[model samples]
Target chain A: MATLGEAKQMILDPAIRDWVLLPIMVVMLLVGVLRHHITVLITGTPKKPQLKAVRESKALMRGSQLRAFRNAIPPHAFASRKAFLTEAYDQGKYLKNPNAPKEGVPAPNPMTDPDMMEGMMEGMKKQVTNMVPQMLIMGWINFFFQGFVVIKLPFPLTLRFKSMLQSGVDTRDMDVTWVSSLSWYFLNLFGLSSVFTLILGDNNGNILYILGLHHYNEPIY
Target chain B: MARLDFEAASLELQQYRQSGERASERVAYLASRIIKDGYSAKLKDDIWPFYEQAVTAALDVGDFRLADECIENLKRRFSSSSRVQRLVGMRYEAEGKLADAQKIYDAILEEDESNILVSKRQIALLKLRGLKSEAISALVTYLDTYYSDAEAWIELCSLYLSVHAYQKAAYCLEELILLQAANPIWHLKYAEIMYTLGDYSLALKQYCRVIDLHEDHLRAMYGIQLCASKILDNGEADGTTEALKELATERILATEVNQCTIDSIKQVVREYLSVA
Candidate 1:
């Protein structure tokens, strides 16, 4: 209901008594923006941990879980013909049934069985063989290529420095004093921190040597 | 001058205490401050902070209705933020008003289908009416349009399993296996189904496969015993009862790798032989 000047005066009086005070808020906002830009530049290289190997190893373990119990629980002597014969002797009895009826016996030569043990062993070999390089590549990529795309950009300060050097500015002119005069020392510090963060910050790298990610008989690096 | 300074500091302290009293009292104080001083240019900065304080106090006291009014008033005078719509949506839903909740969730989803809160609320409403299939369909639809989520796949598979749809369950499991191929449990479950359908020979191979992968797989050991018994009976061309006894004796005398598994296998064998 009041005049616009009265409303304008009401809003500005507490925060800004005069136009001179606006510059302070503007300066703070500019600092915030510069800080944000530097952060983005440093963090642009995304490190994806070598997930494929970890996944492969987990898959192998799961496949193993699904299949068989290779090691016998009772000592072979106890469960085998030798143990039965010993037990019979200890009980003071002759062998009642030497060839007892049984179900689900493995082939006589399980190691030689083409369809069963041999094939599975081969699969295990393949899984282990494949997992190594995948892990190495992932680790190398993460360690080497952390801040990927952002570093490729024409960042303002980097551009300015390139131009300064190109214009025959002495290398000594690039010292802290000259840079400080540009009020960009803090910006550069923030930028470097961000780049390191982008390259090395992911937890996926640990998957490389983790036992569960490797093949059953494969050598892990 | 000392007296004036003392009075001003005391007035500021009193104002702080008065503002902290309650939502109604705080709102009244804010109204009085603006009404008396007219939110003039000289007081604009101070008034904005006071406005924020009053709005926050009202929301803290659960006086959301008044808070909405305050927000609307502020928006009319200033620029509105997307956060206001979010808060308004939450308040409307909290008040047990589904129509309004739906409207807000719809608006949010229209802008961002991946907004977790909007999807969550939307799913909640669909589930409340026992429309689980519809909810699942909606989730599937969302998944198709956006990200592929592993947890969602597992959830959908479990849902299908709960309903006793074995085919769908198998399909879901197969999809998961394709993504994570070495899952042992999936193989076990698939082998179990194959066993139940009387595919004994195939089941035996799976059991053997399991044992090969895991040297101590008790379940696979039990499966092996059953499959071997089936093989001993069926492999004989003459199908003689004598041949069955021969296979049975070989099994009973055979040394087991897992004693506990052998005992279980022994029991299952005895039961099957007795019935046969």
Candidate 2:
């Protein structure tokens, strides 16, 4: 439907642009840089793989690779390797603990497995570092800049953007191009990835990849 | 003065330095040569890595003063870095203060269990102090964490071989082969290990693999001939096995030294190959 008399051309205050838009974007950018450094700090050194666990995994890798590249070697050589590996597999020779009771033992809890637990702790640390600042900034923007339409999009959007682009502002008939502070935060959250990649190099600790924030896109999209 | 010849040594070490590779012996040579000739101070700022490399190399060659100077420069720049602290630990090691070095290594590991460099240096210290068994166990633990490290696998193999543990060495070589699938050297070593263990068939297979990878490898050709002759002696000869034995003999003789022809082992190989 066309606009009712094409009337609502809400002009946002220049003060909000100065006070809200620039601050939120700058704060988000700084937080992203800080998060990258924090993740680097948390990963103090490259991890040493546990010998038994590495052997266990590498043994499986070797077997699969041998099978895949069996043609690289002579057939008799492949046969010798296949036979040896098959026998080893049957006897569980490469198992971390071949003598462990297999019949009645329940699977090891992830919490109890120190290696897995350490991995989880590292992941948790990174996620917390990523999410905590994000949440705090979001809450801060919601409290301070709620319903304040801070910036206008350069191009026109459909009426469908009214709910998304004006998250905190409860404007019924305002243009969908007017972005309230909270949606601006959302825009900056996803949009600053290229900035982060430039700063932290190509293999960066990007927020979206670490926390899988794309999950948030389903309802919005 | 050839004693003042930093140019040649620097040129020789340029590739290693550019790639951040370790050439300990040559590094030790060039580093000492520079210090002895009093030319380190003249080096450019682009050679900042020279300090780190020189420090380790100086410590290795027992040039404590040079090590101290370089490490002091590094310490001023990166006072609390784990890598620098590791160099400090090696300095302590060079000074015969094994316990002090061990303490640093332990503390480094306590803070960061992933510092396999420290773990490796500690293992080397153990082996240097003649603690063979301890070194083996330490390396075993290191390998568990860094199983894909081909160098660590090679170290483990040599350690096993040092103790004359042929089977264990063979197992380590197997791991090495898997890790470095394209390297002819590991295959050759595995073949030698299998030969030692009297698994001639497996050894013969590995020898053939080495030959396939390295077409003109003298050692692999010799290995193939020996293993094939052994297999044929035990009456396991098929067509391909006989052909491999003959080919190895031909290649070994075709070489510049004409090994078999000169050494009279050619007659023995011919007789061995000619028997049925």
Candidate 3:
């Protein structure tokens, strides 16, 4: 067995071992040592995790418009459109044929009708109205919450709620929006509680490894 | 014929001199004409002396608009004149077009970086634009490379305070106090920072020092009373409270504290006493 100094020296060597592998090993060792005691210290084993506040509120908004835009694209538009366009746009002329005449037909005008114009106006209004609230909330959240100076929060619950929102959850479900909203609230509560217990699950994959129950762990990827 | 022409010219000049505003307008118009007509030889021989006389007369009467026009015409005639840019910077500053002023100042500084007035105006424009850190850095570099000016130090202190850099603000004020110890504002600001940092006793002492340095420092007097009350409320030691009360009494008797000052001091005193 290597001496403690030798073990530390061996761990630090640039050539002998993979640097990435060492951090991973350190994290695993920390988690195994500390995982059992985290719940006891944080939740005290007797108290059930409170769900009342979690079920009543809306989730904090996260992520950006670009992510949503990419996710919303329909899958079929690419394959069929590409196949049809490739043949028509090829540089080489069509194969030789005897006395062949090309036929031309004009496509119907897209934006010439009154009903279509009305619908377009309505869509534009809806788009603007939707964007206003999103921009306002995002601006407020960015300014107040992300200013260079840290603010003293009046309550820990607000911090917990903010953390839940920052978890990047999409809090909308099928016909009933309440289910998703309740789930978001609970997610925030659980997140804060875990943070209190030193078990925060970060969505950003930042270097802040949640200090485990009794020891340290590498950050969860 | 020559005598009649000379008499008519003298009467016209007299009329222009009698009406200052009219003279400015006439000077600007003639300068514009001379510049536009490429009448350089005529300007040198006759028009320039008349133009120089008009510009000096306009400046004497504080007619900046006419002065600006004259200077612009002069630049139009003498495009290589270095003095024209400095005058333009001053005109922009006087007009309160700070962005334009800054641009002109920057141009002047590029040609002559040691120009004090241009550097000062440029820093002021940076502060107005909310470029606080940049203003601070520029002024610091200017101070480091050249002799210090009291106005520059004061502006630097204000920038530090605006940015909530209390420690740096205190240090800057300390520098100024060393240079001119009688400034009550510096002492007040230093005391305010000390209060914020929970050095209530030290803050009270600083406030007392301000009062000692300037008997009419009502703000510092009020601050001392407030700090004393805070000390009482926090259940701190008795030494600071006795010292503060004594200073307040001294100022109250000496200056015959104005009701406004008394009211404000009482308000702070009440707040601390109630909390205590």
Candidate 4:
């Protein structure tokens, strides 16, 4: 229960700022920019989907749009479309596998589906690529710069933040604003995201996809 | 950014082109000017898009030689690019070799059915050949895949109108209205089509909707009066119909028109209001 008067302040050596803080920030920035470019290069141009596959999804979209905007059209046009789409839906005309067994059809084996496997592999590759660099940077920072306070936040913080900002340091009664090297690495990771978006375009890193918003498939207009 | 010199109008115009604007006429003029002045060589990689843009602009102004030269330059670089190939198709279309242009578009579509640019080009080619039915079917197919494209909806609507399929045209206009409810043009077109289809009540509603969005629309005012009179002829005249008719006439007479046409327009409005 240290009050504001009892809070301890430590003078950080300028050598820590020059060697640890600035270098970490610079490395983070360069790694971010490199990650963006590498993601672009790895993504290349997407392969074109099959014509029937495109038509199937689009036809389903058309049906849904027509249903949603049905009031816009006259009765006759709406009626005709309703009948046509109803027939198509009943016949499973837009299904990718319309001729498949209808009664008690076995669920597809995940490992046997090439598209499923490829998608999982792609996700795993991205995860590993994203994680390896960060883990390596964390280990490198820990090995060389641990057991030292790297930077100081200007504003005062409560004792609650001491464990967070002083993770690698064992000192008690130190001010919460003095952050350890590991915490500095985290600070760089969070702060450089905006810089990444500034240098790259807004859609960099497929933020929505990474957030699992793709499965929700929100109406994009 | 220093302002370019007064003599550098072409270079200034090039700024708009590089920034992806449609300064087609100036781009055409400058592209030829750049080649003549030996400045095209300096553009290097940037010259490709300039030539592509100039090709269409040159064709638009009927400079076949300049268009051909631009097309030639594009082909030398991106010989296999579908984009460059589409330019060649457009060049052939301008040359009045419709079949040749059709062949090129067909080849592109065969390779990639999802090529939206080539799909549109093929439809335009069909329309240019005055094959209305073919154009309508092609556009309908394109719209199926790109159900949200407002431009294609407008085109399909106009095509249906030209073919005298008022019901179908009305459907297309309804789709457009749903797609872009803010645009008064779609409401006006829908009103006109409903009027053509003899659904005067719906027509009047859509016309009033247009008025709600855009107060000074002359055609919509006229459409309101027309629909009011038609509804009156059906013995469905009400106080609101009469008021709408008077309002439309008052607004129409208040609007500005040329001196030569004002008297006749006033007379027409007077007779229309009297009938309603």
Report per-candidate DockQ.
0.02, 0.15, 0.00, 0.28
Model 4: clashing residue pairs? Answer: none
Which regions of candidate 2 fall more than 4 Å away from where they truly are? A1-13, A30-149, A155-178, A196-211, A214-221, B1-20, B24-54, B57-66, B73-83, B94-115, B129-153, B156-175, B178-182, B193-204, B225-242, B249-276
The CAPRI category of model 3 is incorrect
Model 3: DockQ against the native?
A: 0.00
Q: What share of the true interface contacts does each candidate keep?
A: 0.00, 0.25, 0.00, 0.35
Off by over 4 Å in 3: A1-221, B1-84, B93-103, B246-276
Residues B46-165 of candidate 4: C-alpha lDDT, one tens digit per residue: 678778778988887788899898888888888788899998888889889999998999998888888888889989988998999999998998887677778899999889888899
Give per-model CA RMSD: 27.0, 7.8, 34.7, 7.2
Tell me the TM-score of each prediction against the true structure.
0.34, 0.62, 0.37, 0.71
Provide the TM-score, chain A, model 2: 0.83
- What range of 10 consecutive residues in model 1 chain B has the weakest lDDT sum? B1-10
**Tens digit of lDDT per residue, candidate 4, span A49-151?**
7666777787787777787777665676679878988899899887767897787988779999887887787777676656666768878998999788887
Instruction: Tell me the whole-model lDDT of each prediction, alpha carbons only.
Output: 0.47, 0.80, 0.51, 0.79
Best by DockQ: 4
* lDDT winner: 2
In each prediction, how many residue pairs overlap at the backbone (N, C-alpha, C within less than 3 A)? 49, 3, 1, 0
Stretches > 4 Å off in candidate 1: A1-221, B1-107, B115-129, B139-147, B196-214, B224-276
